[model samples]
Target: MIRFCSRTKLVANLIPPSISISLEQRHQSIATIAKMSDSKILIYLMRRDLRVADNPVLHSLIHNKDHGFTHLLPLYVFAAQQIEVSGFIPEDGGKSPYPEARSQIGSFWRCGPHRAKFLAQSVWDLKDGFEKIGSGLSIRVGMVDEVVKGLIESFEEPAGSKVSAVWMTSEEGVEEKREERSTKNICDKAGVDFKLWQDEKYFIDDRDLPFEDPKDLSDIYTTYRKSVEPLREAPRPALPKPEKNSLPPFPTDVPPQHSPFVIPTKYEEIEAALLKLINAQPLAKNPPKCPENALSVHPFTGGESHAQERLEHLITSGSITGYKSSRNGLMGTDFSTKLSAYLALGSITSRQIHASMSVFEDGSASDDRYKDLKGYGKGENEGTYAVRFELLWRDYMRLCTRKFGPQLFRLGGFKAEENAHLKWSRLDSPKDGFSKEQIQEIVERFLNGTTGMGFIDASQREIYHTGYTSNRARQNVASFLSKHLYIDWRVGAEWYECMLVDYDVSSNWGNWQYVAGVGNDPRGNDRIFNPVKQAFDYDPKAEYVLAWVDELRGVDELGQIFQAWTINDEERKEELGIADTDMVKNPLKRIDFKVNRGRGGGVGGGRGGGRGRPPYRPHSGDRWTGRRPSSQDQGRGGWYGGRGDRGYQTRGYQGRGYRGRGDRGREMRTGMMDKERDATADNE
Candidate 1:
């Protein structure tokens, strides 16, 4: 993390023009030294911190002009093999056939089509930015270590300049750490220096924290929050782009002039080179586009220019003024700040956003329109503080990665003393009375969004289509899978890694652990969400559910649609477009009573106190037909409230409705009590 200028200040000042040789002689001497030792070549190994402005590592080199570096090589390596992971290997020492199968599958790529598209866009954007400053980016597709070594060796030390140093921003995950160590080893062997600096992408520095040592920081978020909230440091100002003329002048001897910073590789032709790498795989019948456009209200474009434009809109459009109130919304473009996708890819930076917030706060406090709006409880600074508070959570996750290291990746996260008594399952093999066959069947259904739970199905479908979902939807789906379904949390985490465009290693894993009762939640309680209640509460009109769930959208009864699996053949065909003979005969799998009520007794004994009830086990062939109540028993109230034919109006859902529900809607109401009874029996 050392700055070049700070380290060499004395040496630079001592070599003033008054005491040195003539300017012409000095230039010749520097040129001779540069050719002799190849000391001017600095390789900037661009990783997560991809932007030019406010990028600490890049800024450090550009600022310390007297460090004798005249040429810079900006390099990015696309190492696809790094993402491969074994899906589920048993921990109890039993032999499994999965290891051999995984080996055969060569590419279990976690970065899916959507994220791949976003990544290509970002790399192209970065190359454009470099071109503006008389430089170009070198993109290679291979193992980072091997490619870097080849790049260093290709530099002929006698005739051309060799690499003097390699520079990159410090990273946090286990794989990133391994890459960093490999880079250091490569530099050591090549006799080149390796410099790593902490990237301020998460907005805070460890030096600003009150703790003497970062490891001493608590796993509990509240403790960490309380210690730093009032004492938070103001973010550093973002740096300006280097002047065009400041770049090394072009060589004039050649017929066509060229910038000194250009690299010798064929990557100089960026359009052709980048396109080859992006489309390395054979094209499908249909080509993939950016995922955000399909599922999100506001489509996110990848680039620093777009990032800056979005930030300005948030401030000037008064979106920042009301962020606190609208952040939890599930449907709209303005529901939450859509900056996360850009932040994950480092297209935009936290420092730049923080600086923008400061300006917005100062300006808006005096404006008449903003002054009249209700302050978010912390006086006039609530909106700004709220945004900062969220940023702190992002920082906490990153610091936790440093403090806990590889433990964050483990299934039993942090291994809190309170969780010692629990005996958890891997769900890949039989354990705790659940058979392997049943587990696999259920998990497959859940992943495919065919578990027959309306709310869960909709959320999963949205994520599959968009590569993005609201935080609320994420919590509900995660809770349902880990708590109610009782499957391996890692599978869900990995699935998210494969799907989410904004997936961050630290944030995604850390959040999964928190929801699964395996991470830093002080209560040691996993969050259990009741999908029915959540759907009713968040999407009161069932608009979100209707949008993603096609089956429910076609159903005629607004009130009875929640229990659509119970409908008789004749009514099902008339209400929905399906034929009477084609109606699914089996009952929907019963969503456990405890799950419907949102009871908590997740892996680590939750809010219900002691270890509570064992996991629920439904009867054999727990199909939708068997689970539904018979005609005689269906004369009671509906699942949530009321009986048949509840009048409905579409407020925000583009105005769609049902014409009829038939007599079967009343019959389905009688079974609500029976469902509650089944819940009691499961607890026993």
Candidate 2:
């Protein structure tokens, strides 16, 4: 990785811009001169770093005068290995035969509909950004190495100048590294330069770390944060967006027939092509739509423009000031900064967000108009600090991926030798205690949200429908699968890779290992989260559960809703209107185990529960039941009445426990209008 200071000096020495002419004017002159000669094309192979702003490669190319490249070709390739189906599936029995990317372990679509749509939207937005600055993005679908090789060959004609070089941002994934090596070999065979710019996705550059090597970095998050927090350059300032016409002109001299692949430039044509690719996957819907109920929780569009808007709103509205307290919130748009999806796809850089927060903290921002906000002028408070802390955690995961290499994706993870004693059920190994069919059933039940644990089920349903879930919910669900169910952690990780629109390979797999007692958790096996306790703690009124789980929506009491199995068949029929036969048909496959006596409890009751450890159970008495509001207080419009449930009224749905919507409820409904307006807008 290149240091920022060194990169700056290199650019200055190479370009040495004149005071008379602006960088854009110089680029225009160079572009005009190039049109008179044979075109020397430089290919920018864009991957995760999708945005044109704060892009090191683009910045370097635009500033440098004597780089020898006359035209810049921005190319994005949808890798075949990531998009094509791995194995065969029957076309008959109402099944589609089109290719889809399936996971090796769970057979889940590697790039599911939600992520596909998000990626497509991001690519289109990037194209727009480029066009606005006098360039265009060329997109193709194929093996990356083959695609690059084809482009090099196409430009080798007598009419075209020699292909100068191929540049791309470096990534740390095992597969990504492999692709890089293969592309380098292709470039070498053709005597072309292959350059990899250091990845600028993280808040802190790797070279600024206190440790010499990433492997020497601390495994614990707290230790790592403490070491780096004191550094003045922990989060460097963001690079400016390239000026208009600063980029070399797009290669317009080459005819369409000269290219190996068809390039669709129109928005409609691009959207249609992306839709075809996405729907080719099994179980994919016609352009995946977010569930009506999930609109409030995940009202997001994938782009740099939307990302900036969200960051601005969070800062200006003083929502980020209360982020530490409200971040664990199960529902609502402003509960947390929904920038993960944008960050994952590189719609916006982490440095941009960090810089914005810094500006807000210093009270220097023009839009920092809210004076009543806590920590408005404070250098670092709990809220702003917590956001930075999370960003550091993201950096740590990526660094761990680099340090651990292939072990990051292995079954036993980095500490494979120490985790040898642990036994997990694998689909391929019947000796591991579960048959292939049994393991399939377990995975399917969990994925489909029919496991009967209301907290886990609700969270599962949310991710399935909207491609999103809060961090609090994600931890609980991951723990439920890995620590509670004793399934292979890789299976859950791969499933998450398929479902989450914000999926990052390092974070997703690294977190799974941490939760499964095989990675960088100092607590190890003690990191288990009891679903029942988590439900009452994070979602006290059962509002989140009632929103997603349809079967539990009929139950009014918080305890009955969270623990539906506890309600008898007679009560189910009398109150919930659920028949015993219907219950039998869709049986509650609840896992039962002994409750903990105290801190150091009983043993040997369930799978993986060793000595001094009992299976998970809810606490006794009122703690589990929760506080229920009385019917007389309905007119007061508290938790159980009025606007609480009326938020869902716009969608023609209402919880059984809440009162009917009224005129007053409609006026109070504006509070919930944060998401309503954005939800109706077409983000894609």
Candidate 3:
């Protein structure tokens, strides 16, 4: 299935008028294009790769040896069935921690609110990006293979024109691979060509892997990393946007609703429109913005421009140097490069990041102020090696999926037979002590961030609220779910698949299986993480715990606060010297931390300089202003239509800044806690 291709240069030929007339009845060709010269049309089937920059498929399309295409129709299919019916598994009755199943046209839909919102924003930004290059994306809502077939059937090649091939970037998931095969089958039946390029989402291109066969990739990450690090073959450089002449304008006359080609402006209108099209909802609004001072928060905005800016900021600000040490920080954007979401969506290519890193490493000046962490073996560049190191880890996960195929999605993963004895059978009776009801209750509490363990709750609350958390937080919470509660790892994996804004199939499931002791953990079935010790080690001052878990804000001995749920409110207020207040559910609230009047209490109790650390502002100016569509008007093709060059301005968090579900947090800060700071941090 490896397809390495260059553009075909064959001369365009006209299909007979007889065939053209028959095709016309099914698919109406663009009026303007129908009358134009006999140049053919090329459909760019946009999938994960949403950007115009560094797109190999688009590049090959335009550079076809014949230079044959005069029309490049960019399309995106909202695969409703794929999201609802394929990857998701509903709870057994009321036994799962996540939401109950909701049917959309007889099938269950699994995409959550936050991911839906982020995806909408990313697609909108993508449309804007394409328009700048003098083209429009014809967004369709349906299964990809069927949509492509319909488009091909309707295509009336001009009197002497032919349809060039349909092109798309390859995907790593088994389902995506199946869809690709299906798409090619449809194309074969229709007598049209289908082409694919290796998706360069990872730093090491699959075609350029050091191993001769994918099966040769190590089962362990370290072994794989050691084998590849020495080759030092820099990723292929990114290509710039194609010339405007090569991009023909999209048809503006496509019917609305079922096949509308424009980005919906508001969350509700878009939600409603998408629901009507496929009987599914995209209801989540943008998440709330973290305070400007919260350096550790991702402050994520979807799209390629934002991805580039974040990468630049990391390099120029010298944050890349300490990346190895700070990458695991449990909170905030500065702890690690917040590029995963961008990478996951294909907004930015891994080659672009690696290329940029190489240049930065070569040009960066050394500083004597910071000490290098021991054992932080980086790339040739002293401090940046860890960034590449992480990219290699991402590469290995993708390779793992490729090697193991669909089995990666199963409960036992690749080692099903080997781990058979460790699998626990389901138990339903409450009288048995380990009943499903009890386990479900525990899962519910974990999902709601009420597990009574401060470290675990804060991490869960972060993901439940923000659709994100640090890798450390994920591991800790996952350990609690699998090792402590002994729930099926698939449940947590599926929950994460629905919730995480940066969800990637291979990485998410692979990591979950690893922790659950069902996947490729050579360490065998002994994956245990102590929440208390983890809290003490990662958050000794309990600043992170207090930031997300408001109830523990006034507790003096932070160590004891992990189990604060065991204490009655009146007892806690008296013991911890805080006001008696209702439990806060939202993390965006403004909680007032009053100093203990007599004994002394307020954040670290004067042990770590009172308020602890000053707010960490990573960027000099605002980062969220440029990407939001100007109006929420429905049926308007001009929301981003007339912005001109300013459309791509690099200002205030480029693209629509993620504002968590747009529900304002309850304002709880008052009196002595008047000094309000941004709530922040996530490290993964």
Candidate 4:
């Protein structure tokens, strides 16, 4: 029921030939090990934590026996299919990816295209990970408890060795508790020994939790921070590659499809579907560079090998040094530790990374130590603690998610004040004298750099082409969307969730509430962004503006056409494509102020600007470099998302770029608009 673990080291050892061969066919030494008391099978029921390294359940099995091969019957059951098989794309377009399910307003709720694509891809990647290490993933469909029970029964039919034990791991929150209990029941019915390893905190164990139970958690983040600070470092993490030999044939029938290891399939499809959807929408123009292997959209590669690859790369390449300075920026790939998704998915446990960070702190966190560590490249003095602080923050969000359940899924609670504003925007005609078309008119104005709100216009383009923006821009945009555009905050949250590559459910929903004056801003800081002044301070030279805004291109003094659509004019010039010169010049500038163009008018009787988008630039050197390249590739894009999510990457921005599914949109931008502009620097 309980076991003390000094370490979760995974050691590799081969079983003696005597165990498999008859007594007459084996060497004396083989019999000695086979008869030795230590040989056993540890049934480590794999959960979200799929990696073989630093797996405590595996370590426990290894430590208990002295001579036997440490063979753990690791099992994973595929269950999402049970839920998805009932799939019918809703007529209202309740979902995405399939023929139905498309919602411009918070369509995010339905488990549609984005989710389907990602899940399928993740499952495949997970299977591959296991095979690479010489193990097989036994995927079983049906009730999880029943399937696991059958596995133990089958394993016991053989030697009944250590496989007789059911070694379980501790989990947090209600859902996890429920799942944990179900696992225990399976082991109980099978008369197997179930051991639960403790991982109380992300890196620290349960004994180290400052408090127990959700109620014990301090409501204030600062309080939790101060109390949890100066915590002990993680235990040394170690895992040997699994031995080459297979476990003895047990009575249990292992799931055929479940691989030894796999990241869920939700990632890739989500990435592709997202891209396809976005390109088709009026919002997107060109194709984007997609996520590589990109199938899972997890910067975390999902399996042990991929996780280590990133960790080693992180420390050796010196990406960890300038972290403090670049993390908050809105555009570029290296701006932040994109590993959060992997951590959440359980591809790479936080403890392993924590251990790796300590090694990094000594080497890269300080200059003197850097010189000592070789390729240390200046642990470069100071701010390593800041990185540590981020880890702590991640811990905090997890705590919050645990403490608050479906509440984290709510929307109307915090933004009540904006409720009225939301209502008016939907009206056919605003009592304030704007037409029902006002919202779209305003949205169009903002996108076209004609809103007269410089900041709003700049930010719109941020999402328009590059498909990203800074936290500052996000806050500004949300406020502008709510306070200025009078659009619902839910609409904005959905768009952000759909676009941001770094989108974290907790952080995204949490921040949206805070900004909309609903979640945690107790001070009620629901403020507005002065679009023009912000442009002066953040995008003053019009360089950022020049990168996105169609009309401002080539206008040496941007103010010359700051409000290009202000005066009555028709037949004005329009630059409708993404050319190096056009990106630098005119794409949309003329304003047709006439209520209705004089008799015999078409398209409202004005330059293309007044009637439609500035000019659908296939490649303005931002979102995409060209069209879908072909219809066969038409998938949606989200975050560095499923089948669809990837950032705006011109040929110039290719190196740190996402590997598009090589399909339509080459993984074009879709649901999650890849809005964290500061995450990746564009090629231009």
Candidate 5:
């Protein structure tokens, strides 16, 4: 496990004594370097685009030999503000002085432990890739603009080589765009060229899009999907990895101490430096590790090699054929592609995934290497198409971010004018008649997974500990928080930003807005998910819920385990092994579906009378009915109902079914499920 230290210790350990001098002192030190190169250097600013293979910016730099650049300086800056203390810091035993990011609404570390560690791993892998091709990566910790300016100044005539240009992959986020503008301004002042290369992270490039202007793209996903589906087979191919001779020699004239920054080359040194930066933050009490008992189905290691290996395994193992059916699965690694993290970090590109799928579908992969594989030439199938469909969705989200701009992070989202009437609780201030204390209580319970809802609690716990959860779980939890708990949607979105290992700015914020009824949802505010029905539909056997929420494991009866609040005090203490002092006695009091049957009420309500539909009413056969299974209902999927005698019908179950048993109940339980449920049940 990773260990954390005080902020003072963090700062002390961050900078090497040799390079810890002031700007003026650093310039003097650089001037002492005996050797100088006349060759112009081009600084390639590495950001989210972490890989060397298929990287458009790197490809352009290497291929365009006559571009007037003889040497490449691949630089990656760990923005200090992102890693510094922010929000509430338990390690400090008080609030942090640093404010939240301009794009953020909450007070949480912008880069949590998992994200920091993953990023470090990616940087290390990228450095290794460069070294293999007779190159090196220069790393620093500072503001991007400041760092770039310093490097440009350090390379001035008398000191070393002149920096011809600074190139970086274009990003869609408001903050990233702001950083680009700032850097460009600096470059302009220095008379150095600044270029924003079109990012090749998507399946289709912007030039190939049917829309002449990206803003012309539709707000609806289906409309965008139809517009781009024709180009599905035409996604840009992955550029071949650059060879040592094909690329310009990496600049190594200036000694490490004399350079503007201290560049650590070894993986151990890189990771150690990164950990000190991350652990120095007040929120980082301990290095993040997926608990030993965590139900995580796969151990995620960051790198281009790992991403490629996983993609190949998914195809060769015959798993791609069943992806469409198993994508919604809540547990295990093979349920989905599990490549989002890699894609988000740009360790792997969407074009590469598409290209691999195409090879398998066209039966062109039946070569000697694939002869022993199980699903080498399975040909086109629903599963392969489904993967492509989801990839398009990812592209759509990014496009939406570009189109919406800062509005994507706003409370009203893209259609703010239309959503003016919608009110939500705020963490910083009271809203929707909810006091700050009241709002904090709700948000804290949701974050800690003590909401008394089984499915939501289980999902929250999974993300809180493991920094990951299924897409299905994400939707359900987002709805439960924004639609049901009435908390501000940004809180949930920002929290996910801090917690998710596969955090993509566009997808995370766009999906949150969609679920919060503030963005481009054709259903408007009417799209609500009844957690009980969702659990029944996705995790019928309660295997997923039981896997994370240990307290419910003691309840032998499957039905009562899901609806433990309905289990009486006597049964709860004796049979269920729950204590009387537990908060699971009754569900958290929030949106009561029993009374609120109007707009945004009940299970899945609507925005207005015309479109406002009643909440989803499961068919009688599908309903739990809060009664034990009878001979007729037995074996017909009617076994998981609440006790009818308690008068806790389906309405109550639907309203609060996502809550866990209790925090105490979760902590006291220490047993794992004795047996695994049929994997097929995950598809239910």
Candidate 6:
């Protein structure tokens, strides 16, 4: 197979203030490229996604071997261009001023010293990965296309090889579109073969598509499944180690920067000054590492290696098996997959995830493997299609961006339209430019979660402090804040976008619509959260509330769980207008996995639907729905409390145990979050 990589030698060491090569300058300078070899090479640059296995473009390149090709390279270029201009600031700027939603920008790929160190570490590890295979990188600078073109010119002719083809896949905005097109156009004019792959993430892949087009597809989810049932998926192919002797040489310098030194150095000096100032003046002993919070955790490495470590930990320890049952407890890491943060960066790919699930499911039917097949419907379905669906959902968001173009990000909130009228956040108080009292009220509680509403207050505090909240808690808190408290959901969603480690841009926006009454199932009315009821049902023992909100700890894990909803009789009249006699008691629920260990029992869930619906508008059927029975609907609901006990209150749960890792009453055995990343969670 033909191979190509960026020429590190071509990268300039220049920093910003120098003008980047213009398209004309690039064309003029790369004119020598037209004379290169008989066949051409197209090397797709990889960003955070560095794994070879399950790479579709790589598969296509391998498949094209018989077609007289010299090399198929997945090239990665290093230059200032990769730097997020908006993310970096001069020393005098006093550290990054980005809002929380955009905080990842600061440390993404290691923003400054910490990020630079992490990138150096990851790149160093990558160098090892390449060395193992005998291939080095072609690091280059300047315009991406210019550097790429220069390499094509320089490598082809002397090697008696023609650079006849190119292939690539991308996830980006307007500028990326132009670059891809320009490169393709140049290759075409040069008589080179060029191909661009389409990404079909979201609901399903194209081959598995229920119909030929979006309009022809099933209107409902059920119909969509039935139509695609005939076409089953084979386990996606895995990549073998690359042939080392075939690797290209490692380049040293990258392109020079050209943007007015990017940021002023003075800002850096100011930030250092501020760090010292803040630390000295703050009443608290330790000032925040970040002006806001600790953004640099060892838990913050971005790359495939880290992804693997997390996956290994989850599966080997059987955490995946318990994901369903305890995901909602809100107590600690054991309650959720901390994959999202790494996922937010392009560090890991979805296919890498699917293949790992395969390893976990392998076994003969006669062994314990047969038992693992319980909830799988004994159908021998390879993996939990539910997890697959969510992964695909991530793809769908990526797909939406490409398919819809800039319009996808242009609209505001759930409704594919502007929504400036809603009072968004307290920070947007009279200062930055908001005057509405309703807006101010939400801003008040959200800034620090001191709201008297314990459940809401508890969740807001946890996320603000540690950047975490269970899916159940997130939905419930969001619903109460927007629907019940009369605040706009957009503000809350933005806050999450800033704080969530696993935050996927599309999913975050998509989920907000699902909960805030916009997007797909946009509900026109309110879907208020009943804090008291929600606390009792999800955190039933209220251990989660106690754990996050210290004052609430030791008071009562269960007895007064519905405290916000008049946990006692007196408050019902004040909060929900229920009579003292109307305060119905709900019992605590727990898993007895020994009795229902295998077969089909496990887990809870999240997201989706169009605009205008109540926040957290869950699908109609399935466990984990947790729909509290209204007076009229109470009689018809099924018993969720457990077998023979009828007062369960319709908490739609599929059922299973929490992966044992972070269980409180059990042994604590987790390695630190940072160390776990290096071994990486999504492993080979």
* Ranking 3 against 5 by lDDT, winner: 5
lDDT score at residue 410, model 5, on the 0-100 scale:
70
Task: Please give each candidate's TM-score.
Answer: 0.70, 0.77, 0.70, 0.56, 0.77, 0.57
The lDDT per prediction is: 0.55, 0.65, 0.57, 0.44, 0.65, 0.42
lDDT of 5 by residue, 173-241 (tens): 876887899999999999999999988878878888888776898888777777776644759888988
- Rank order by lDDT, top first? 5, 2, 3, 1, 4, 6
Q: Which ten residues in a row have the lowest lDDT in candidate 2?
A: 638-647
Tens digits of per-residue lDDT for model 4, 1-684? 323132211111243444576545444443443333234555556555655556555444445555243454556543331113212222354432222232234343222333334333444555566555555455443346656776665544422333557655665444456667887887777676777776422644545667888667665556776676563343235444444333332223332332221223444433443344433344323322232221221223334556576766666655656666655444445555556545544556666666666666545363443454443433323334445655555565556656765444444432334233333243222323443343333433443334444445555555533334655567666655544444445556655554443345556655665555555444333243433333433443454544545444534433333333332222233342222322223222222122233443333312222322121112112121111113332332231111211111111111121221121111122111121111111110
> 343 in model 3: Cα distance from truth in Å?
0.4
Q: How far in Å is the alpha carbon of 525 misplaced in model 6? A: 3.7
Which candidate would rank higher by TM-score, 5 or 6? 5
* Candidate 1 residue lDDT tens string, 217-255: 887766777776562354556677665545433221111
Q: What's the lDDT for candidate 6?
A: 0.42
Residue 120: error of model 6 in Å? Answer: 8.6
Model 4 scores a C-alpha lDDT of 0.44
For residues 330-369, what per-residue lDDT tens digits would candidate 6 score against the true structure?
Answer: 6655545566654554445555565556545544223353
| Prediction 2 TM-score vs. true | 0.77
lDDT measured at residue 230 in model 1 versus the true structure, 0 to 100:
62
Question: What is the C-alpha lDDT profile of model 3 across 1-684, one tens digit per residue?
Answer: 222122111111223235546554423333323444344567888888988888877677667656556667788776754343211212232222222233211122345656666776788788888888788887665568877877766654323345567878888776688778999998888787788877766677776777777788777666676667652464667787788756665644333423323345454555544334223432222222232232326557778788888887787667777776775578767777878888788898777887777655444325522223322233355446666766666677778888887766665666764433244312221121333344444444556666556787777667766778887678777766665544555556766766787887778878787766666666535445556545544675777777777656666665446545333456666765433322222111111222232434323323243433322212112111111122442232211001111011211111221122121111122110112110111113
The segments of candidate 5 whose C-alpha lies over 4 angstroms from its true place after superposition are 1-37, 85-103, 157-159, 254-266, 272-292, 372-375, 417-422, 569-571, 574-577, 580-583, 589-684
Candidate 1 has what TM-score?
Answer: 0.70
Clashes of each: 8, 0, 29, 116, 7, 101
| Stretches of candidate 1 exceeding 4 Å from the true structure | 1-39, 83-108, 231-233, 245-294, 364-381, 416-427, 432-435, 556-563, 566-570, 573-589, 592-684
